[model samples]
Target chain A: MSRKYAAKGIFLLLLVNLLLCIFYVSAGAVNISPADMFHAFLGDGKAEYQNILVHVRLPRMAACVLTGSGLAVSGAVIQNVLQNPLAGPNIIGVNAGAGLAVVLCSALFPYCYAVVPFAAFAGAFGAMLFIYALARKTGASRMTLIMAGVCVNSLLNAMADAVHILWDDTLTSAYGFRLGGFSSVNGKVLLPAGILILLVTAAVFLLEKELEVLTLGETVASSVGLHTTFFQFLFLLLAAALAGASVSIAGLLGFVGLLAPHISRRIVGEECRFMLPFCALFGAFLVLLCDLLARTVWAPYEMPTGILLSFLGAPFFLHLLLGRSRRRRKKHD
Target chain B: MIRCENLSAGYGEGAVIHDISWEAAEGRLTAIVGPNGSGKSTLLKSVIGQTSVERGGVYLEGKPLKQWRHKEMAKQIAYLPQSRNDASLSVFRMVLHGRFPYLAFPRRYTQKDEETVIRELKRMGISELREKPVSELSGGEKQRAYLAMALVQGAPVLLLDEPTTYLDLSAQMELMELLRQLVAEGKTVVAVLHDLNHALQYADEMVLLENGGLKQCGTSKEILQSGVLEDVFRVRIHILQDQYGKEYYGFSSEKRMRNETGPAASGHPKRLQIRS
Candidate 1:
């Protein structure tokens, strides 16, 4: 029965994702029709329509899908590894760290696009390690880990702000990316991000069993013959890669990481085999929908995707926080 | 055949169980009993290589525990901690995790694994709750579910820490009897128990620990005769026999109570703390 629901859920999500993709492609600044979008998809559209769809909208859409899926899957993996419902790339400092690295690369080595993503990846990994170290030092409780993430996030964000202030001339180019939108996305960013997302998402799928066992907590996971330390490190590395790649493309898109996996888990239980793919599709659909609104809402003016996400995500984050505390209080009673 | 040779282990800086040499023979239920903070759980954890060894080592079969691959060790020894995180997994899925050691990378459970999980659920009397989330179960039911998970590992050696801690009287007895049945089926079971009477009644052999040290290791009868329980726990105990001649150990804080209340408290009946 649940399997049937799961199938229906997947089908519905795919349909929504397809429709959103078409809407995003067709309703943009150039207003390509559904026929033209279909023709572009088939590689036989009119030349100008094909160029607009292929070169501009398609890469932007691909960036949205890749970044959205990567962040959401990374969020799911981090939440499992840390055993904290609130843990994710943005809250846990991975995106801030990546953003800091991107800002630093842009300031120091202007126009070197390839170096930015790698730096972002390295920064994300470093931030994860930093948060882990802090959590370990403080006994790694849920509250302590989140607190550590907050500290790392603030520190990295401040550093990025400092870089912006110090190198004010580069701010114009770096500002939009920092706020996280698909405006700057082209084949250069999309291609590499797409490949990395595919690889890491597959890798996460392969680690599905380990991730599920890990949700049982470290002691039980280790006792059950999982090399808990090794797998934790590997999962963290994969999460960092995913989050870092997404941050490079989308520039600190918050909440999708936290929001999408959570919604997927609610729809399909915690089994990663089902949840992971669902999270990816759900995440893509969400970002595409949000981006479509961002584009068409006020016409010529566009809201940054990150700002829209924060507005949507903050209340949800607070709700989870309060709900967790309330549950803990009830358990005590 | 699990043996600890002067095994000294602990967390970060200090050894919790120091230089404890003990052996759990095959096909017997061995209970490690001690007062709170006596390192009973630490000793059990050390046996499974969960603790940091400061000195000496543990051996499973004949090989040093460190030499055994984690998967190989998991195939031989199954361990259950005193407490587990409230993971929201179904009973069937939770039990299936026991097959992790047997499954290779891209770890998909096989037909045999599913069968074993089902069998364990039935054996633990939780087959009806296979689809139920563990978090929704009663304390006793949760313990049974965890036990089912451990049993499905199919290991010859089972180590459980305070398996009956949060259970009611009947649930405690049921779990102990289940462990005994496992022993009867040729599995070696080592459990850390807080209830001395339960340990005495259910364990074939008992190890008594006091202040991070091994005080006794022998048959329950031998440990009873050794008079270590009173000394280690700092309480006086009396042995009572039922009509069937089954002996039960009962504890009293009478001596301390008398000291506090003075000589006038002597004629008053002493309260017996009976644990069944």
Candidate 2:
């Protein structure tokens, strides 16, 4: 996009974000008053308002922001590392791997929510390794990699189902997680995941220059003295850690990891300096807006945040995908 | 000197370059020419330790390639791959990646790196396209951008694969002139090229590669003779001296067509004189 237009777009989004933050805090089951929200902001609200603001609203808002940045930056990094437009933690196998891990934990034992995420992290890491190795073998096997991810997901899912069938009590008990939502955020799981994402994100930004060199291809990257093997592993790890951690807290947000960064790149430009940060912000805004709508759009009865995201994010995602195609066509004409 | 002592290249059980020994002197533009699949690119990759050379290794100033780490190699030898047509990089960032090997553990690009990149873009005359995405650039612009990246690598020995493959007439001449200028400034450039005319015009030295080994290695005056080229390339060629008193060659066009049809023709001129 034109730089002027991108600047304008970002400015407008920032304004919308401020409005959404205000509006989101006022929304929920209790239907708190905006005037009371102002009091809470001014540090002199009533007990209930303070309780809602401090406990319920702030953490969720922070989650929106954190998850947004995590998924978006994760997507951008994955795409560049894989050298494929469609490559990301969600669209490729990383999320599936994480999801598989979560399902595995949920299946194997009936007692540990925390271990599910570690399982998720391991699964995501494995998936990324598979993709990299598969690509080197076949020369740009993105579609095949995605296919491999899907197959792995299905097979794990069947394992999950079989476990569910055998242990019928377990299946019915952990059903909420399998469906995907942000209904619960335990500090034990949530805090570490949050900190992990931040650390990984910092590392990614730090490696931005090396990542840029990496996209030039392995031989070129190596000739210039980059440890291409290690760099590839670094990016793959970053994507896995972020996605696995996020999915553990919020089950399978789906495509935000792919969609967010690409949109950020289009809006801001391909400099990772611009792309990574903008993707993170816009991604957070997208998730927050969806979560807010999940609470308010139907009024008093909340939709799953995943379903709400699908309703809003999919059209935008399709528009971008088709937009990319139209662009390639126009470049010639 | 950049030395390759008994260097070998292969992947998964087959070696292409076998025990090859050579040294590229500093400040010399050495051109390597070979037929298709003569393992020129393989040799370049192996020199930088891109491909696993199972038998031998490269040395820069008497230190083994393995003794110094990857980043150290980057500081010494820069390799430019054959140009890829599909990638989106701005001219500015493309050159900036050349600074990759120099960045420390918590790597951050320094302002000095930017200055060096801009300096290269200026030298290449593509400073105007600094912000333009690489996809939109003309053939010459892309070549310059890649060359700028190699310069950013800050290596004494610059290895390029077909640096002029996609260029137009004037662009080719301009790139050759730039390379000559680089050699004058005490940088060594090793290029793999198919164009004999380019090698004859600018290279200080030339090496002919055939069937995964060096056929002849010498000065351009010695190595570029029609007889040597014919022996190396498996085709007859004739030489002509240009107005500048330097030799150049062209295939005898009719003779080339006639030679393409058979292993040997009964009535061909000097059939006995030519070694098969």
Candidate 1, residues A175-230: lDDT per residue as tens digits? 78667888777566566767888899999988788999999988889888999889
Best prediction by DockQ: 1
lDDT, candidate 1, at B263:
39
DockQ of 2: 0.61
Question: For model 1, what TM-score does chain A reach?
Answer: 0.95
Q: Write the per-residue lDDT of candidate 2 for residues B80-195, one digit (tens) a residue.
A: 78856345767787778889878875567799999999899999899999989987888777888888999988888899989987788888889889888989988999998778
Report the lDDT of model 1 for residue A126.
95
Task: Give per-residue CA lDDT, model 1, range B68-150, as digits (tens).
Answer: 88888899999999988888877888889999999974468999999999998988888999887788899888888888889
| Best model number under TM-score | 1
The CAPRI category of model 1 is: medium
Kept native contacts, as fractions per model, are: 0.67, 0.71
lDDT of each: 0.86, 0.76
RMSD in order of candidates: 3.2, 4.4
